[model samples]
Target: MKDCENLATCGFFRKHLEAKTLACQGFIRQYCQGDKQDDCKRKIYKQQHGVPASDDMLPSGQLLAGHEK
Candidate 1:
């Protein structure tokens, strides 16, 4: 699987990667840089809405607490 093409510009990743949380890293490995890239909720939300999801939105589609922007 290829890394997600959107990684460079993904707001969620840019915002959360600073924390370096294991959960965030896991999500990146599982969805952003793995076979599940196509299944990423960020990709799905953008594809379905024609706009990027909120920066706090995780790859799994769950919003991170206290990270809203």
Candidate 2:
């Protein structure tokens, strides 16, 4: 499948795509540009809430390390 339609504008990708952490980058690879894009919590939350989740929200629906925003 193609990459996510929201890749360019996704809050998570725009904010964290450049993160040096392997886990962070892995999330991007696993969701933003992979087959799992359809399951991204960020996309799901946006669809459900009509707004983006917090910047610290991972595509897996978890918060970033030490981050609860």
Candidate 3:
């Protein structure tokens, strides 16, 4: 489906638009215009995954490393 169409159907998007929140409208105006689907994808990915789409926010730690006294 197209990005605009997908966004229009999103529950969060629809709710925010219906509520007429300034931030939501601004975001839609900025990222949901024309062919910039990646913006929507990243937003949705963050919503579903509970983290930023990029790796920068991931927790830093050594795998299987025990506590060091």
Pick by lDDT: which candidate is best?
Answer: 1
Query: Please, what are the lDDT tens digits per residue for candidate 3 over residues 1-69?
Result: 344545544544554456555654565565554454455654566668775443211111112122121
Q: Tell me the spans in candidate 1 whose CA falls farther than 4 Å from its real position.
A: 67-69
Instruction: Give the true-structure RMSD of model 3.
Output: 12.5
Candidate 3 segments exceeding 4 Å error: 1-3, 34-36, 41-69
Which one is best on TM-score?
1
Model 2 lDDT per residue over 1-69, tens place: 788988887878877766547777898888998989999999999999988888788999998777323
> Taking the tens digit of each residue's C-alpha lDDT, what string does model 1 give over 1-69?
788999999987787778778888898888888998998999999999989999888888888887433
User: What is model 1's C-alpha RMSD?
Assistant: 2.0
Ranking of all predicted structures according to TM-score, beginning with the best and ending with the worst: 1, 2, 3
**Number of clashes in model 3?**
0
Q: What does the lDDT read for residue 7 in candidate 2?
A: 82
lDDT of 2 at 50: 89
lDDT for predicted candidate 1 compared with the true structure: 0.85
